[model samples]
Target: MSQIPMFRESFQHASKELLHWFPGHMAKGLRVMQQKLRSMDGIIEVHDARIPFSGRNPLFEDRLASVRPHLFVLNKIDLADMSRKDEIVSRLKYEGVTEVILTNLKNGQDKASKEIVSKMIDMIKSGTRFDRAMTSPSSYNLLVIGIPNVGKSSLINRIRTVHTKREGKAAPVGAEPGVTRAVQQGILVNIKPKVYILDSPGIAQPRVNNVVEGMKLALCNIIHDHKVGIDIVADFLLFYMNKAADFRYVKAFNLDNPTDKIMEVLVKIAVDQNIYHKVKPVTGGPWMEKLNLEQAAYFMVRKFRSGELGKICLDSDQLPTHTTATLSRQRARSR
Candidate 1:
């Protein structure tokens, strides 16, 4: 029988500065969101499902969630391990989140995507702030907010397509972070009991919690790859997957076996895929062809993001082993 390979128990990196990413646009976006808060009846905060427990901007809860009925849409569920979804929802509920929905916004016909409109309408009607909304009974305005590249714009566009049957995108969508720079004007989504959604820029917390947390965000493309270093991010991905006993990347990257060293994997990927660059020697000799480790790193990370590697949940370890009710019962029994 083939023995299982052992991997690193923990991840180590040189500096935490790579994880810190708070641009000028993020600050401006926060101010604009605060200004528009009073006009909104409810909030829909979208996030990446893979890192459900990581990288959430706490400011959203302190400044926005407290005043309004907030619904969390964990987008990109297609790329996440749905088996642990119940635990994720339970943990979120414990953290004061009243409503949570797992969705894949890329699919226009997705059931969860279709449910968002009705869900928001219901939350608005049932909320204590409904009387304030009655002043403008015909329309319900909701603000879409979350950290960068969690598909805030995509969620708005998907909802618009579902309710209004409009094929054109109301908000621009991009694969990279910082796509939406400022709060956009409300776009009409539903006709009767008219519903309009305000698309706000993705706001990331100025400081990340820790290196591992930042790595999760970086791996999910919430933070720019260059900021955290692509090679370093790829290493974290390998470390995370290995610790989870997931070796799907070995097949995805065409490696003979699972190994902990990221450089070995990158070298193999570069050689097998013919990803190389011409480098000039310091001695001024002829240009030498060397493997492009950077390109290889990007290719590896992109595959994971696109769900080519496999469906994974970065916060699987953080999920509660027992339900909140069960834990409460155990505590009561102990007492």
Candidate 2:
């Protein structure tokens, strides 16, 4: 009989400093966003669905969202685990989030994407600033904001296509973080209510809370892979999957079995993918051919991002077992 091997119970990284990534553009963008806040009727803050409870910029909540009708659009729903969707929504609601929507912007015609404009308009009309919005009844201005690479630009383009029936992209988009360097002028989307959305650059927190949080951000590509080392990012992903008992990678990468060692996995990936580079020996002899583990690490992380492994929620552990409403009812019943 064969025995199952034990995996890591937790992940560890040497440096947490690699997680802090607030560049000059982010600071400048924050200032520009604040300047434009007075003109916006509402806020649509986009975030990665896989990381509903992680990597969100607190400054948005403290400075921008509180002053307007804010809606959290968790983008990339296609790649997230929806099994706990109810718990996620309930927890967000308990945390004082008035509105939340899960969406996959890649599908321009997705039901959630189609409903965004209407949802924002409804929120603006029913909010404390409805009278202010009424003053400009012909049009509503909204700002799309969030940490980098969570699809803020993509959302604007999707919304434009849905509302205006436009074929071309209204805002620029890229797979990498910090694609949009500054706030741009509003692009008109709806003709009836006259919706205009201003796309803003992704803003990350100046200091990350911890190394694990940083790794999560890196895994989502919110931070550059090199900042935290691609190898470390891949290692953390392995640990996370193993801890959750997810072994899809074994089949995905053609591994004989699951193992806690990242080097072994990367070596296998490198060999299987034919990723190699020439290396010079320290003894001043001839250069030798070696497997490129760095490239292999990147490939592994990319697979996870592309949903080849399976649906996953990085914040699944953070969700409350009992919702606030349930706890209240329980307390009342006990009395």
Candidate 3:
């Protein structure tokens, strides 16, 4: 019988520029979001559940969240493994985050999405409204904020559907980041307590400090695919899967066996799909056509995002107090 190949312990991209993707629109959006924060009653920050521990913009907390009632929602819970939800929540609490919610924002009927409005009402009622409290207003205004492509728009649309039974999208949703360019004017989502929400563009940090953190964002598709080459992203995905000891991709991609070489894998994908590109010889010889490795890499990355390989939590391997306690109990029983 053939033995399984050894997997990689870590991933390193060829070009480690650190995936800093702050576009011009984000700069303007941040300014606009802060300007509208004074009239806002509460703030909701959305983030991808796959990489809950990293890739968050610290500027949101420093500039907008301090004065407002902040709610952190880890969206896309269906795409993430929630077995360690308590551990994830515990880590956030330690970092001074008291209000956090796990939600599948794409689903309008989800209980968590419905609870968002109620939670916002509770937070606003319990918290001070700053100088705006001088005027007794019957309605509440909320600002939805987060990093790129984390589903801020999708959440707003879902909430709007849940409460108002709205037939259409209140905000534009896209797979790519920065879909919402500017801070949208007040959008009515609930009528009972009179709630209005402002949707803001997804802003990224000026710099990504860690390479792994950048890779996580790229893999989760928070960063644009072209900025960080698809090959590099796919390579990191393969390395990450192998590091986690998951080989679901081998069968998904129809590979004979697992291999650490990214080009080898992309070549197979290209051959299987008949994807190719024309290339001229460097020596000025006849133009040579070759397999489109970049396209193949992108295909592989897309499949992973669509959950074709299998269900996975990119950050689930992170062990915390909850995991340690379980490990301790198991050890005791084994002894």
Clashes of each: 0, 0, 0
TM-scores, one per candidate:
0.92, 0.91, 0.88
Global CA lDDT computed for model 2: 0.87
- Quantify how close model 1 is to the true structure by its C-alpha RMSD in Å: 5.8
Clashes by residue pair, model 3: none
| Cα-based lDDT at residue 143, candidate 2 | 95
Off by over 4 Å in 1: 14-16, 132-136, 321-335
lDDT of 3 by residue, 1-335 (tens): 14667876766563444555688999999998888987888999998887887767889889998888889999888787676788888987777676999898656567888899999878877776644454545788999999999999889988888889887888999998778988889899998878999999999888886777788888888888778878889999888877665666777788887778888899999999999999998889887789999899999999888767765677765654345665564334322
**Model 2, backbone clash pairs (residues 3+ apart or across chains), number:** 0
TM-score of 1: 0.92
Provide C-alpha RMSD values for all models, in order.
Answer: 5.8, 6.0, 4.2
What is the lDDT ranking, best to worst? 2, 1, 3
Residues 1-335 of candidate 1 have per-residue lDDT tens digits of 14557899888884656555788988888888898998998999999999887878999999988799999999999899877678789999999899998898767568998888888888887887688645548788889999999998888888888788899878989999999988899999888778999998888878887788888988999888878799999999999987766777877787777789999999999999999999999999899999999999999999999999868888977876656765464334322
lDDT-wise, the better of 2 and 3 is: 2
